[model samples]
Target: MATSNGFGPRALRYLESARNLVGCAGGAVGLGLHFAGLGGVWWPGVVAGLYGVGALLTPAPKPRPPLPPRPEPRPEPQPLPPEVSAPPAPKPEPVPAPEPAPAPDPELVALAAYLDTVPLPPSAGVDGLLAALRAAGPGPVAERIVRHRLPVAVAGYLRARTWQPWAGPDDPDPAVQLGREVDRLAGELA
Candidate 1:
């Protein structure tokens, strides 16, 4: 009729039954594995290991002792001396600001200008655009064009590119695929 700590006797009994069931299940599994030539003679050891771990984990009960009353310690007293204060020091001067960064390369500047001049339109069919990109030659610009058409073309490309999953958009951890999708979506939407 009595309870200890947080759990009642019924709960404790249920826990014991569950633990016994788990132990039996583990032993049966180990035995089966051993007979199947998977676990070998180590099956008994495995069972014993599980039981040992369970026994070590099981909580033991102890009687609660009475709490002792608290007594505060007395505070120490301080002696006063003659008052003598020193003057504060002067503040330091401000630091010099950093210089501006150098200009970008002329080739990079020209490329940026050229890219700016290029008209980006959603109505441009992906196939025609991709063909144009391929014809333009192999470079970052061509890669950028393919990246732009990814949302419309990537899924089909990926499916055909492999027998197994080619790290498609539907995949759980498709970081590169997701980036490509975003870039294409942004390009089309823009």
Candidate 2:
């Protein structure tokens, strides 16, 4: 048909059927390209373009006399979905920051490091304090024991001995106390 656009029927049909841009299977290729485009991939679009595949062009509408406007229809109200009506999830509580570990006692740490090498009674057996010191390292527990507790224990032992030097069987032996201390320190350190 001779129209203002100047495209003959064959040309118009060709424009509408740009699917055959590459040749056969243009529609299938174009569909694949469309899906790829939706998925943020562009290689399919390139392939489609190379194969001469594209969106089908819509023909221009034929001119006609205008008609009177129709009355507006009211839209039906839809009920909210159960999910939409459900309460929102509660926000997670903020995690508390962990407290920093206290510092080790410098004097006790040095003393512990040296204690293992120091000479002791033959009964002490392989120096538990040294093994414990090595195992536990000069950490906070060791520091606390040596700095705050050990001296007090030692002083109390010495005071008891000074007041009552009877060499009695009931009195705590230094060697025995050393072994016990080793076991206790090892447990504490562990």
Candidate No. with top TM-score: 2
> What TM-score, to 2 decimals, does candidate 2 have?
0.32
Model 2, residue 15: C-alpha shift (Å): 99
By lDDT, the best candidate is: 2
Q: Global lDDT of each model?
A: 0.53, 0.59
State the lDDT of candidate 2 residue by residue for 59-142, as single tens digits. 444668889899899898787798788677899999998986645546756655655465555564435554455556566887
- Candidate 1 per-residue C-alpha lDDT over 1-190 given as tens digits, one digit per residue, 9 for 90 to 100: 6556556766776556646556566667667777888766677797676665654554654558978878888787554444644455778887888875544434434443543454433343434444344445455655554444443444543444453365567554333444455456445443
Q: Give the C-alpha miss distance for residue 138 in model 2, angstroms.
A: 4.4
Query: Compared to the true structure, candidate 1 yields what TM-score?
Result: 0.21
User: Looking at candidate 1, what is the lDDT of residue 167?
Assistant: 51
